[model samples]
Target: MFDVVVCKKKQEAENIYSFELTLPEQGYLPKFQAGAHIDVEVRPGLIRQYSLCNPAGKTDRYLIAVLNDPASRGGSVGMIEQVLEGQTIRISKPRNLFPLDENTGFTLLLAGGVGITPIIAMAEQLQQLGRDFELHYCGRSRTSMAFIDRLRHSPFAAKVILHCDDGDAKQKLNLDTVFGATPEDSHLYICGPAGFMDYVLGQATDSGWPEARLHREYFSAPDVASADTAGDEEAESFTLRLARSGKELKVAADQSVANVLLDNGIEIPISCEQGICGTCLTSVLEGIPDHRDYFMTAKEHALNNQFTPCCSRSKSSVLVIDL
Candidate 1:
């Protein structure tokens, strides 16, 4: 963890604020990539991940934008209301779960609402690399969008296309027109709310876009029911065996694997307990994991080698995990 101070803060849009964080001692921060994010300690025991929206190559400071979401479990509220400029806070080094495929011939960056955070960094990096890419930003309205003026005046402004729901119908996003025939060597990166992402992904899929070419990051877990207990009346009790300690713990039907482990004095690092973050992903040595996380792809879940213990349960009665 690094101790950084919020150097500056500005209201970007309605209920959205941007914070610039810099190391107190004046040293460069660890270099981060385009789609990297850092975990911030919002409160005593509350941690939340926010994407780096600033230019990627620059290491002097990290910029993050937060929206005061009404449905937030507390992260957004704490970040917007509690964190102040010049306040020192703890944050993890940048980690990139949604990294850009630099080798792709062309890129299509899409952002919805506050999901523009990571896409902004990606646009900067792509421009610096002289790569072919276009950015599509969609919002409810012009006033609700963050970084509108910044994007309009950016060097790559010509490559940006804005679509607002309240705008003219012709200017609205048409998924069919935006995504035509799939390009062989082009990739698509999308980030936004669950419904927005689902709509975009569903359209892309129906258009014959390959799963490998479609990339996305979710700010919150979707409302879809977990495949683990889709039709089941209730979750079944399971046994978790620690490989290193040879200790077995009973996971009750009403309890999560993470909480059960914590109750047994076994704590695993966890952030975003909703299963959107892969912080607590653990390898399964034996038995199958009833995967419930959006972090891992379906291919990874098919292997059943690792699972997010925070919200994922087990299919097998006796499951062994690598501690």
Candidate 2:
């Protein structure tokens, strides 16, 4: 864990706030590239991931922006109203699952709401490298957009496009026009609300964009619709076999593997229990897993060697786990 002090905080938009963190010793912190995020430990056990918005290869400080969310479990509210400047906080090392693909000929960045964090970093990198790219930022209105002033005054302003819900139909985003002429070597990166992502992805797919060409990251895990819980009696039960200790645990139909493991005095580090954080990833020694988490890629899911037990279960009758 790296201890960093909150040096500056500013209200960027309506409910969005930007924060600058620096090491207490005033030395360089860890280096992070575009699309990397650091997990900030708000309280004792309340850890939330925030994307690093600073330009790539910079290590002097880390920049993050947070939106005040009333429906938040705790992280956003604590950071917005409870945490103060000069107070030190612990943060995890940088991790990136959404790194920019510099090999792509032309990059199209699509951001909705606060999803501009990573995209902005990518845009900065692209500008510095003189790569061909465009950033389309969308929000409810101009008052709700973060970093608008910065973008407008920056050298990359010419490549930035703003779209608001209050704008005219002609000024609004037309996914078809944006993606219809995309070349085979072009790639698209998206981050935003579930419905917005679905709409954008659906339109892109209908326009013949391949899955590999479209990359995305979700701020929150998509709701995993389970089969009817009312029919628990009809649901199938599974067993977990530990390879290390050779211990077997029976998992009920209505129970998750993590819950059953905890009940049996086995502890597994988990966060977001929704399988979005990849905190509880465990190795699968044997058996097929009914992959459910969005953390792993399609190729990783096909390998079937690792699984997040927090919400995912076994596809076979029994699963052999490393621990």
lDDT of 1 by residue, 52-169 (tens): 9999989999999999999989999999999999899999999999999888888999999999999999998999899989899999998889999999999999999999999999
Tens-place lDDT per residue, model 2, 1-323, is 77899999889999998889999996888888899989898888788888899888888999999989766889889999877888999998898878898877899999998899999999999888888998999999999999998889889999899999998987699887887656667889988766687689788888888888888877776543436322345557888999999999998888889999999999998766666778799999999987767677677889999999887888889999999
C-alpha lDDT of residue 164 in model 1: 95
Global CA lDDT computed for model 1: 0.91
Model 1, residue 305: displacement in angstroms? 0.5
* TM-score on alpha carbons, each prediction: 0.96, 0.91
**Candidate 1: segments with Cα more than 4 A from true spot:** 226-233
Q: Report the number of clashing residue pairs per model.
A: 0, 0
The Cα error of candidate 2 at residue 123, in Å, is: 0.6
| Residue-level lDDT for 87 in candidate 2 | 90
The collision pairs in model 1 are none
In candidate 1 the C-alpha lDDT for residue 137 amounts to 97
